[model samples]
Target: MLSQPLSKVLGKKTADELIRQGLLTVGDLLHLLPRRYDTWGELTELAQLVEGEHATVQAQVLRSTSRRTRGGRPAALMEATVTDGASTMDIVLFGGAGLMSHYAKQLAPGTTVLLSGKVGLRRGRRQLASPRFQVLDDLSEDEREALLARPLPIYPGTDALPSWKLAIAMRTVVDQLGDEDVPEPLPAEVRAAHRLVDALTAWRWIHCPQDEEQWRAARRRLRYEEAFVLQAALARRRVEHESTHAAVAWSLPGPQSLRADLDAALPFRLTAGQVRVGEEIATALDSTVPMQRLLQGDVGSGKTLVALRAMLQVVGAGGQAALLAPTEVLAAQHRASLEHLLGPLARGGMLDGAVRATRVHLLTGSTPAPRRREVLAALAGGEPSILVGTHALLNESVQLPFLGLVVVDEQHRFGVAQRDALRERGGVTDPQALPGSQERRTPHLLVMTATPIPRTIAMTVFGDLDTAVLDETPGGRSPVATHLVPWEREPWVEGIWRRAAREVATGGRVYVVCPRIDVTDEELTDLAHGSLGVGADEPDTAGLEDLVSALGEDPSPARPLAAVTEWAERLAAEPALEGVGVGTLTGRMSPAEKTAAMEDFASGRTPVLVATTVVEVGVDVPGATMMVILDADRFGLSQLHQLRGRVGRGDRPSLCVAVAGCEVGSPAYHRLKAFAETLDGFALAEADLELRSEGNVLGAAQSGRRSDLDLLRVTRDARVIEQARGEVQAVIARDPGLEHHPDLAAAITERLDEESQAYLERA
Candidate 1:
């Protein structure tokens, strides 16, 4: 009954509106929680109004009028004169010829209403502009007081139905559905241990909390439920996935094997951590059960090398492997890195493909049609090979005949669906039936992430996969010294360019990163849409480098950021940087141009590369020791760390200069300061989680909403999430199919719908 269409529960018109806004079923409405609660029990008088202060006031409408906008647009303005017993104020509501038309008639003379909005002064006349009002018609003072006593839920509104209307509809739904009608998903024993109430009670308190504490407790209960259901589903997936049959059984041979040959051919010795991680992956490859593991290492911790070893394990078993990168640049980089590491084995040595031998192929959007067809043909054949590319690899037309292993670089950048696509490359659904079937088997999965995930996040967001951390940095890598340079200090600002010039003079390169590619209002609109939970198009590139910074709206809402073009132009004309060659790179740059700019910077043709955060990942220039990030407050904590990591790759001592425009003592200022003080990515990741929460951690590619886990915060509610996960595992262990816990099964099914469950399987 709860799964019935909204049209069956609500009216067709209301259902249409809800469905248009992506709220379809009755359950969706229950989860369409209030963004906040407005406590209007304490009302201010008209005389007490302060400019820019949000307030609620009880006033009587003396008169009302509607007029066209001054510019003579189709829009109109609805105005009203209202007064409390103490003083009078104006209510200006901007509208169309029909804007707030319904309200105009209702706001007739002598009508009493409750008005709430930011107080403003228009030509010295105190007014409430576009205030939200509630009619108090036919209501006694006692009734009005009683209505105000309950916290008013402010929901996320849509064009068809305002927040107030949503609140009304939800109240109706809650009233119709009795507390007993909504069964408790969690077992009574579990709920008692966690001190949680029933789901129905939680919904009631959430939608109609009598007080702040009530709403908080209600939210807590819902958060636990969401985390528990998701964790339970993931735990079951892990169990099933680890028990599945492998398509290719690959046991690492002795000292004379190709794996040994490849390892020996590498120029540098593997770190102890790398050797340990490699052994773990090798063991998983040897198992009949397919591998689903995460390899997390700091920037340049040899993740590619570890991934290559796993890919070779599949190759040794006469199966192909595909590596998925988030961007074309990163994909191309991976292809090049693999080819370099594999040395002669990639071409004709041991794991070679001289015609029928093992081969390595590169596939990307930029690859010519003929070359793409060639790569596709090679993958379709039975010969063992390694294919590397971006989302192009996930295209339905691309076929991997005997693909037994999959490696995803910057796995977090891709959505769960894309990973699933890659993992299902061999075209076999049931790996368990591999013993009888001639069909190719499922691939062993190895996902690599350069961004360090917090422990709490790793447990919940990627709880399904086994994790391996590459904690040690390779030898000869210099530590990057970070410093916070306030923009207000002119001398310090001038010194940055001088320092860049000095670095260039010393034969070292410099990366000068700006917040914006160009100064435009499009950024504002993009940001506005993103903040409203609308899907915003991301920067189209490979390796999902600096996406948060590229898609990032301003961290400091009150201030604008400096643009890359303007900064590059200024630097070109600066006397201090006259001798230094400066080149600019941004998302707006053509693929060819970006490549050329990177080449120039790398080869010392342009010693000073003034670019955007596009250089945040996978652009290795060991010679570039100095990085200056302008308007640094515009970036998040992890982003700052990534930008800093771009430098400090070589033996020379490196320095990162972060220029922050934020006012001292501000949150942005303190955040930048904290980033400048710490080089530890893991610590900074924890801090980042606290500051921004995990936005779109799981559904980043599938959805536009920044953070999908609205009610639960991974950082603050780690204990709750962990406890829920444990309890869920225990429950699922006793009843794998959840037959014994029908309520939990139903709830998990509802919460983790088919689409969501499919995505989580990829995770």
Candidate 2:
């Protein structure tokens, strides 16, 4: 049943609907397990039911009615009044007339049924809307007993095919299975060691379990399988990468290299974490193979210093280094930062014609034509230099004749192919070098991300690359005090402006962030859901409890939205912020306007700058020590952490005020509280993983590729991923090309997309 097409089992119309929902194959359907289970073993009286809890109730129908909805949308509502023991409740359903008529039959007066759904208040009266129902008259004694003994699975479905329809299809598929053996990809020894049930049993228990333990066991087995396949693929990629040779491995420095000079010229002492990561990169650059490393650090963790140390080595060895930034703002920031850190060492002493004025150049899409032409000519001339740019570096016209090192900041923003294209430029100087030949001396690659990643995710997604972490911040960095402000409280709402005024009076600047750049709420929903990493891939159908459990609070729907343009205008006119310049910055603004706004805020001319997420990464204004985030609940954990890091760089203590109008019990509420309680990015990152799956962090969400995770969660399955990683390493060691395990190799290939396969080969 798991191997045949769905069209053969379900009708063509149903199959097409499932296909539209991304269920392309029979295996796809099998992997669509329920998000949660519902127990129907016992029935509760209407008076015993608690608000917000889902429960099954047995009651006699007292009244029934069906009527068309007010709007002319061809929809109707079916309602029934039921009484259990002492209290009564209303049952409501929303659908077409056909569905309402169908429910009207089961809800006849004096009918006895078991109804299950969330208990809520509708117009001050208890009600259960769109619940699962079973008519007692149609069930036999044994059938009723079995139904009461087992838990029902609840799946995410649409109106055309509800949860009941999916359950019926699943039952038909299970019945058709009969005694045939299902395909099991894992080896027998592995399954036996883990004490997991066989594939066939796992599938049955996952969809139709008699007890909680059975479904839990089934999930473990499936999760292990998913982790195993992913680790094996990563292992193969690592093996292939290590076996290749590089064309231009730069020589290591002796005692008096420019890298040592740059390190000694730092204005402040290096942190322990920075020194450690810098050494790791230096060692990799000295190796014969082109280095492929990931440099991860929290915001304000001195990642730039480590990258600069690596770039200096390339320049000292008579080669050019290129740094790719995600945005033009960051590219300009990097260029200014490197020039400031380089002191006067970037002058013509290290390499010929490398004057400090010409050594560090910025080349973005907005560069003037004259400057762009001059920069292009200098790059083609083979001068030892450091060029920082955005996507413009990937253009075919730009060339680095002696490129030796490529550093990418916020690597997830650019696809793997774009990074490879820059590295490929290093080898293109020699026209005779073949595309995939070892004679092509590709540049050593170092990718950096300020997004603190959980260890499990780093291993699973970037297993092929060497990892170095910078977790410690340098001395003199003040800790930013965080506070969560509920907009429902009038005092807190009014105090937001007062806080900004006080900060400005102290000669410090502030940052005000909004979810949307424009005045409209057109993308507000997308902004909220996107922050949670739920969109085209993972849909959000979670209930109040799911939200509460993940967010650590109940949700409210009365939260107000913050728009950048509107907030900027409001703050500028506010009497509290008197004589304080308030400026608006957004992606829609011109580059010159953005630069001027940033300059005004940096120079203390503008005490307040209201913007969107454009300033989320690498916009360093140490003088700004106060940040106010409006609609703070709309952001995810990692994003919130990054925004808070914007302050606390100066000698004075900093403060971050998160203003939210979100409901009290919502996931957003919980997330904000959790963020306010801790400043550790790593801890917040782990929580982010549980709240939001590792989709965005893994970069698969951006690539439009299948994450290939059926049941495995990187946050909870760390031990399993480690175990699979070890086993796959041993297997790959014994069979380098996987000749002895063709099935395993084929499975890995099937799991990886073409882009990933190419990325692995290029790296």
Candidate 3:
């Protein structure tokens, strides 16, 4: 019955309405938990009602009047004065004559009613305009008392179906529900251990609770159930992946290998965190079970170096490794960084190359045809080499027959399918293999993210992968000081340009970050007419939308925001920055343009580079000492931290000035203030989680399809998630296939959709 379509139970019209809200099955409707509970035991005081505020009041109607308007179209107006024992207010309703007649008969004098509407002041008297009211006189004495005693569940509802209507529909369905409808997903022993209620009882109490305690208990049970099913699915994925997948076991490099030679030729010693994480990756690479590891580190923490070393391990063992970046800029940057770091080792076929070296090649969407063919041919040759590229690497034509390791940089930018596609492209089938011999192999995966993930998120989202953290920076890396500047303050705004000029004068580079590439004509018109601020248009990207909404800002009629094009042009002509070369970089720019701009900035020819978040991740300029983020509030805390990380890479002390356009004390402003106060990526990650929703735990941040997580909050449910993880691990340990827990298995299947299941499998 629970699995049956909602239309089978409720009438078709009502069922369709609920289905439109993503509640398809009876079980889905049962899980549509109430947003909150409203109590009728204490009615809102009429005298305390504030104008323009929504209020729900219980009172007795003392007098009533009905009249027809003489104006344009005939309309009926009904007015009634109501009063609690202490004070009185007016309720006004406007509608057709038939509706007014009905309201007049229903709201007769001496009738008790419960009314809800926005309070307004008319002729210096408080009144409710077109209030929704329920006549209490119709209910029996006992029912009236029951209503006053028990709290009413208020669900998240649409305009056509209010909370009260949803409650009625839920009650109708729940009344006919039986034990078989909501089977016990949790085992008896597990329920006893956790002090949780049965599934049926939880569902009943969650929707129609007798008291606050009952509902709280119900919520707790359901929250745990959500976490348990999620964790169980993840555990099962891990079990299946380990058992089914086979990978090349690349051993630790010998003294003369490329990995060892790179380490020996390094200009600086490895940090303790890097050394520890490197060992973790090395161990995973040496396992035939296939490596599934996530390497997360703070900005400037040498994550790239660690990943490079792991890739070299595969190359040294006579297998190819691919580094997948999310953008062409990052891919090209990675290629250049690898070449610079490896020096002669990256030029294996050249005369000046190291004897035991291998080649490093780049393949991007913009790669020239001849060069692209050359890279593809080299990969198909099965010779040990390192290949770096963007999403183009996932193309069908790009194959690595002897691939042993895959390193994905800025892992979150790519979807699960993209990552899996690259992994699936590794190793060819062996037709002559014996029955027990490994028929095919997948490459080991090492995904790196510079954005530190909070503990709960790491467990919930990346639970299938082993995690390694590089928390320390290399020696000689400069410490960055962050400051928040209000955009409304003119002196502070002028100081930004002056500071950039000063940094340029000292031969240090500066990065000026903007939220958008350029302003649109509509925005320019709005600015010229002073009707709306610049960037009044909605954010071009969903990320900015989510950030703005999470910061509690209305994206419509957006505040004035900075743009790379406008800022670059303005700064180039600024008196303070006169003759100080300013360059522009945005994602819309061609690869050559971006590279040239970055090159000029790196060489100090263009001391100031104005760009968008395109340089958020892997752009390294050691000489850059200052970063100015215009409209910093438009960016997420993690993203702002990443942008700030572009500087302070060298021995010079760095500073990051975040210019906030949000009002002082707003959520976005506080977020920027927090970013300015701390350089700790982990702490900022937690702050980021608090300020924003955790999004879809199963997939990409904003993928709404798999975001069925209504009860389990990754931010505030740390203990619950941890407990669920432990319980799941123990259960999976006892029953590898969950064969003994059919109900739990069913629950897992019900909770995870096809996309979510696929995500977990690929994750």
Candidate scoring better on TM-score of 1 and 2: 2
Give the Cα lDDT of each candidate.
0.74, 0.75, 0.79
| Superior by TM-score: candidate 1 or candidate 3 | 3
In model 1, residue pairs whose N, Cα or C atoms come closer than 3 Å (at least 3 residues apart or on different chains), thus clashing, are 247-441, 326-543, 327-542, 327-543, 328-542, 353-357, 696-706
Give me the displacement of residue 727 in model 3, in angstroms: 1.1
Global CA lDDT of candidate 2, please? Answer: 0.75
Judged by whole-model lDDT over C-alpha atoms, candidate 1 comes out at 0.74
Q: What digit string (tens of lDDT, one per residue) describes model 2 on residues 54-147?
A: 8889889999888889988659989999998599999998889877888888789989888888999989889998888888877788877777
Least lDDT summed over 10 consecutive residues: which range in candidate 1? 528-537
Q: Model 1: per-residue lDDT, tens digit, 630-726? A: 8777665656787788898899999999987776776577678788778877777776566555655444332223666758777677788778878
Cα RMSDs, all models: 7.4, 7.4, 5.4
lDDT winner: 3
Q: Report how far residue 641 has shifted in candidate 3, in Å.
A: 1.8
Query: How many clashing pairs in candidate 1?
Result: 7
* Candidate 3: tens digits of C-alpha lDDT, residues 1-763: 8888989989888899988888899888988889999775445799889999888898999998888888755488899999998898989988677768888889999999988888999999999998868899889888876777676899888756778779989998888888877777777877899999998888889898887888999999999888888888898888888888778788887787888899999988888998898988898888788888888888888888999899899888788889988777778889999999999899888899999888999988778899989889877767689999877887888867787888988765555676678898656433123323435688888888776443334453536667898878888888999988877788989988988888999989999887666676343222221110112121233233224353346354356567777888999899999999989877656678878889999998999998877788788899999999887776667678888999999999999998877777788877887898899887887776666656577754542223457787776787888888888899999998989999889988888778777777776
Order the candidate numbers by lDDT, best to worst.
3, 2, 1
Candidate 3 accuracy as TM-score: 0.86
Q: How far off is residue 735 in model 3, in Å?
A: 2.6
Question: Cα miss at 181, model 3 (Å)?
Answer: 2.0
